[model samples]
Target: MSDVAAYPVTLPAFVPEHAPPFPGQPPAIARAPRSDTLRCSTCSMRAICMPQGLTPDELKRMEALICPSRTIRQGETIYRANDSFQSIYAVRVGSFKTVVMHRDGREQVTGFHLTGDSLGLDGVSSGHHSCDAVALEDSKVCIIPFHLLETMCREVKVVQQHLHRMMGSEIVRESSQMMLLGTMSAEQRVATFLLNLSDRLRLRGYSPAEFHLRMTREEIGSYLGIKLETVSRMLSKFQRDGLVDTHGKDIRILDHESLVRV
Candidate 1:
C-alpha cells in the first residue's frame, strides 16, 4: 500500500465551473474509446481509480463496458434517498455532498466527495441508496455498471485488487471523520478539514495549499458539528497566526505545517 503521508498532493491550477444542460434540451452524450467500451480510457480520475493498477488489456476490457456521463449541474441530485442503485459513480470533476435526514427534520452530512471520489459503491449488495448525493458544483461523473464491473473483477485480478483498495480507503476515511467528530476541538476540526481538502486536491495535480471554498461556512460548520460563528472566528485566527491567508472564499496556506499543528 502507498503511504498517504508520503504521497505528493497538489491542487489543480484551474477548476472549471460545472453547468448542466438546460432542461428541455437534449442531454449531450459522448462515446468512450472502442478499445474499452465498458470503461473510460481517457478519464482524468483513472489514475486514482484504475490506471497504475490495471494492465493495458484489462483497462481496455473495463472501458468497453463502462458508460461515461457528462456534467451534472450544481445542486442537482445525482441520486436520491432510496433510489435504485444502477451504477457506481466516479467524480471526474468538482465535489459532492451526501446527506441523510432524520424524521425530526435534522440533516447530517454523511460525506463530502471530491475529484476522483466514488459513490454508490456501498449500495451494490443492498441495491438501494441510503443517502442523497448532491453536487456542490457543476460536476461530471463516469458511471460503471455494477454487474459489468463485478464480471470484470471476477476475470481480472488487478480489477479485484483495485476495488479492495478503494473500499479500504473509504473505510479509513470514514473512520478518520468519526474520530474528528468524536474527539477534535472546533479549531482542530477546521484545521484538519482544510488540510485534508488540500491534500486531496494536491493528489489530483493541483496546488495543495490554495483553492476556492466551494461550500459555505455554514455548511462547513454544520458538517463539523460547530457554530457558524465559531467557524468564522477560527478562520480569522488562522489568518492572524500566519497559518493561512483568506480573502472571501479564496484561501492560501501560508504555513501548512503550522496549520496542521493547530
Candidate 2:
C-alpha cells in the first residue's frame, strides 16, 4: 500500500447512459427488440447515450446503422481478447465486467459496465478486443458495426465528435484507475470505489444511497488493486462506523460526505 493519504478523486462516469431500474429495486431483464422495429431514436436511453443536437435526417441515418439488440446470457462473454473487432456494443439491459488475463493466467478485472454504457472500444486501436467482456446477468446490447459507424462519422459531424469523446472517456477511465492503484491506500481505494459506484448508479437514475453489488468481493478487490481481506475489512469498518450499511451484497451509503473525505 502507498504511504500517500487518500484524497478526493473525481472519476469519470462515462458513456451512453442507461435508464436505471426503479430506485431500490433490482434490475429488470432486457428483452431483444425485433430488428425491423429497433431504432435509436425511440430508445429510452438515447438522451444520455446519444449525441445532442442532431437533425432529423441525421438521426434517421444513425438509427439505420444500429442493429437489433442482442442478448448475452449471464456469465457468457460478449467478446474476448484477440477476437476480431467488427462492432462496438452499447449495454441496453444489464451489467458486465471486463477483464484481462495476465501472463500467469490470473485474470484482472478492469471495468464494470452497466446499462447504457459502451463496450468493445478496446478493439478499435488494433482491430481486436484486448479484454473479455462478460455479462454479470442476462444482458442486451445494441450492436453498432464500427465500419459502418466510421462511414457515418464521415457523413455526420456530431457522430464523429461523439465517437472521439467516447474514446477520450476510455483514456480518462484508464488514467483514473492508475491513479487509484498508485496513490491510494487500501482503505482509501475501497472507499473511493464505493463512492464512485454510488455516483454512477445515481446518474443512471438508480438509488444512490443503496444498491446491490453485482461483483463478488474478490472481483472488487481485483479491480481496486487490493486483497479480498482488505476490501472486507474496509467494508466492515465502514459499517461499524455508520458510514455504510451492508447485507451480503447489498450496500447503502450512510455517509456520502465522510466517504468523500476518506
Candidate 3:
C-alpha cells in the first residue's frame, strides 16, 4: 500500500503547546554528509529545503531534529486553522493547497505548495495556524519541530538566514498574487500562473514545458480571484491561440514567449 493508504488521516500527537526554551550555543557544523542520518541529509530536495554550506557534523545535528515523515491522502488536511503551531513541514512528495474560510463559510485557496515547499509558517507569529493545508494528492511531509528549529537557527547563522529567506519568499509570493488579482487581465493571470508553476518545476528538475495540474479549475479560480468559467475560458483561448495544449488537467506550454506576451 502507498504510504498515504497505510496511515490514517488523523495527525499523530505532536510536541507540547509550549516547547522548551532554546539551549546554549552549539559547535559549528561538520564538513561531510553522513549516510546513517535522517532522510533530510540525503533527500533530493535537500538543497531547496535546507541551508547550504553545512559540514557533516552540522548536517547530522540538523537531521537529528526532524521527526519521521507523515503521509496523508488526497483531500485530507495536514493542519487546520487555529491549531497550535509546534512544527513546520517540508513537502517531500506530491502537492498541497492552503485554504482559509471566510466568515460566511466560503473557502478561499490562498496558495498551492509543491515538493520542497515549506508549510505552517503562517503560525510562526501568532502561535496558531491561520489556514488549512490539505493534500492535493497522496503526499508526504518531513516534520521539523519549530522550537528545535529555532534553537538551531540561533546557533547557526546560515540556518537563520535561510529561514528568513524562506519567510521572505512567502511574502513576495503573496504580494505577487495580490497584484495579479487586482491588476491583471484574466488571460494574463492564467498565463502568469502557468509560467510561475513552470519556472518552479524547472528549478526542481522537472519538465518546464509540460505537467499535470494538481488543483482543479475551481481551485485555480479561487486562488486567482476569478470565476471557474473564466479560468476555463482563458485556458481555451490559450490553446486556440497555439500558446498551449491542454488535455483535461494536463498542460503543455508550446510557445513560452507567446504566452509571456499574452
Candidate 4:
C-alpha cells in the first residue's frame, strides 16, 4: 500500500469516483550510475528514512538497489495506474498524493506520501501498479527494486518485519479513511484531517500543532469527501472557534482537544 501515495495503505487508499486502468507486466528502475554518490547516510532525511538502522554492510547492499535520487517536478506522474511495477519508492524530499482512476473516469485519492515514507505497494500482489503517484511538490524518491528488497529481507530480519508493519499500517489507515468519509460530517472530516497530518509530522520530529499543508484545499476536500468550498468554510470555522489558526497553507492547531471532540 502507499504512504500518502503508498497504495490504499499499499491500494488501501479510499476509492471514491470523484474519478476516473489497464493490464501490464512487472517492471526495474536500473539505470547508469551517477557522477555524485547518493548514499543513504548522506541523504537529507537519513535519520528518519527506512534504512536508518541498517548495519554498514546491510546499508551497502541496500544502496546497490537504489537508483540515483532525482527530482520529480510538481504534477509529474511518478507512475500511472496499471504501469508495470518494478519497485517501491522511499520519499526523500517533498510529498506525493496517489489517485486511482475509476472505470467511470472519476479519480479517487488513496494516500499522501511525505519524506521517509514509501510508495508502490499496488504492484506487490499483481505484476502491475494499481494506482497513480503524482508529486505534490518538487520532490525526490529512493527507488528500491522490489526483488532486491525481498532478497535483502531474507537476510535482514528487521527489514522484513518493518516492511510488513508498514504495509499493515497502510491498510489500517485506508480503512479509517473509508470510515471517516462514510460517517463524518464536514467539521469532523476537517478535524480528522488536521490530526492525521499533525501526527505524521510529529513522527518526523516536526511540531504536531503547527505545519504547512502541502496539499491544496481542493485536494483536502477530495480526500475528506467534501467540496473545496466546504473545506474552506470549515477552516474558517475552526479559526473563528479558536480551534486552529490558518494563514493559507500554514496552520496552527489552537485546541487539539476540541478538534478531537469534533
Candidate 5:
C-alpha cells in the first residue's frame, strides 16, 4: 500500500436542489434510486457500455448478476494493493482515486474514477489488485463478480463490446494524464483539473460550474504534480481574476471559460 498520509476528505452531502414532496412523485423519490435501474434506463453513460444494446432479457440477466453496495465514506479505502480481486467495482455515485507507491515511498495517483466508472478491471488476470482505491466522498459502487461478468460477456456480444470500450477509455485517460504531466504548467494543471471536475459533476446531473470540492488542495496538488502552495496561489489568482469564487472549501466557478483559458 502507498505510504501516502491518510487525510480526511468529505463530500458535500448531496441534497437534491429540486426534490419534490410526496412519495412516487415526479422529481426525487423517497428511496434512493437503484443505480442499475438508472443505468439501464436513464444514464447518459450507456453509450460507453454494452447495456444500451442489450435485449430486455439480457439486461435483466446482467442486472441480476450484479449487486449494488452501500456508500463508502470519504477517506475510506475500498480496496488495498495486492488484495484479492473478487469483483469489479463500478462507481454508481461519487468519485475515487487509485494510487501506487514508488520504491522511495512517494505516492503517485494513478487515476480518478468518477460516476459510471469501473475499477479493478486491470486485475482480472492476476486476481490481485494493483493499486489502492480510496473514496473521495460518500460514494456508492455496484460490485460485479468477475466470474459472472466474464461468463455473461462471453455469451453476450453487446457486453463484450461494452467492456472493450471501457478499457479503451481508460487507456485514453492514462495517455492524456501522461501528456498533461509532461507539457502543462502548474497553473495550467490546476485549471485543467478544476475544469475536468466541473465537467464530471455536470455529467452526473449536478451544477457544472458551481459545486463543492471533494478533495483538499493538497490532494489536488499531489494529483496534479504540484505543491500545495502553488495550488493555493493559482486558486487565489483565479479568484482575483473573477474566474472563480472561493469561500473556504467551497468553490464556485464564476467564469469557467476564463479558468480554462488559463
Candidate 6:
C-alpha cells in the first residue's frame, strides 16, 4: 500500500454563504450522523432513508423489524457473495464498497455506499447475494429483516412504495454507471465521478468541495472502467488546469462548473 501521509492535502474551509441552503439539508458538520437510537425512530438520517415522512407510530413499528446495529471493521465482510440473503442493511456509520467476483477469480467493484445507503438489495431477486459488501472503514449497519419488512409493506402502502422506489433508484444508478463506463472519456468519467461524489457528500452534510477519498486510485479506475495510469494522468491534468487539488486520498474541487463541462 502506498504511504498516504507522503502527500499533503490543502482543503479550504467550507463557505456556506456561496450557495443557498438546500431544502431538508442537515447540519453542516462534516461527519456521519449521530447514532443515538438502535432503530430508525431517532436516527439523524431518517430524513434520507426509509423513515423519511414516516409517522411516529410507523417508526415505532419499524423498530420491531430491525435488529440492533452491527459493527463491521475495515476489511470485514458484511455479507459474502452467494451468502443467503436475509436482511438488507442501512449504513449507519462510515462507508462500504461492494464487489463481485466471477468464476475465473477476477473481481469488479460494483458500488461505494455511504451513510443512509442500502446494501444487499440485489439479493432480493435471487435468494443469495451476488456481490460482497465489504467495509471501507470501521462501520455500523442496521440489519433490516426482509421477511418482516415484506409483511409491513403489505399492510402499509408507504412502506411498499418506498421500498419499490429505493430498488428502482438503485437500478437507475447502475444504468447511469453503465453509461459512464461505455460512453464517457477518462477525464469526463473522472469528472462525473467527482461530481456525483460531491453531490452525495453535500446531501450527507459534508463539505462538497473538499473531502477525503476513501477509495484508492486503482479502485477508482476499476469502478470507472479505466486504467490506473489513465486515472493518475487525468488527475494531474485536472490539478494543472486549476480544476482540483489532490493529495493522496484528499481532494479539493476548485472549479465545479468547469469539471461539469469536461
- lDDT (Cα, tens digit) per residue for candidate 5, span 1-262: 1111000012222222222222444322123534333433344444333355778788778766665444566766667677677667777677788888889998777777777778877677687878878788878766666777789889998787777766676677777787778999988988888888787667666798788776778777778888989999999998999998998779899997788788
lDDT agreement of model 5 with the native? 0.68
- Highest lDDT scorer: 3
On the 0 to 100 scale, the lDDT of residue 222 in model 5 is: 77
Please write out the lDDT profile of model 1 over residues 105-142, one tens digit for every residue.
88777778888888776666688878777788988776
**Reference-based lDDT, each prediction:** 0.70, 0.76, 0.78, 0.74, 0.68, 0.74
Instruction: Give per-model TM-scores.
Output: 0.83, 0.85, 0.86, 0.84, 0.78, 0.84
Prediction 1 TM-score vs. true: 0.83
lDDT of 6 by residue, 131-241 (tens): 887788988777676887899999888888878878887878888988888888999999988998998888878899999998888888888888889999999999999
Q: What is the clash count for each candidate, in the order shown? A: 20, 2, 7, 26, 0, 0
Instruction: List residue ranges in candidate 1 displaced over 4 A.
Output: 1-39, 51-53
Q: Sort by lDDT, best first: what order?
A: 3, 2, 6, 4, 1, 5
Compare candidates 2 and 4 on lDDT and give the better one.
2
Best by TM-score: 3
Per-residue CA lDDT of candidate 3, range 55-109, in tens? 8888778777776666656877767788788878888888989999999999999
lDDT winner between candidates 3 and 5 = 3
Output the lDDT of residue 3, model 6. Answer: 8
Better of 1 and 3 by TM-score: 3
Candidate 1 vs candidate 4, lDDT winner? 4
Ranking by TM-score: 3, 2, 6, 4, 1, 5
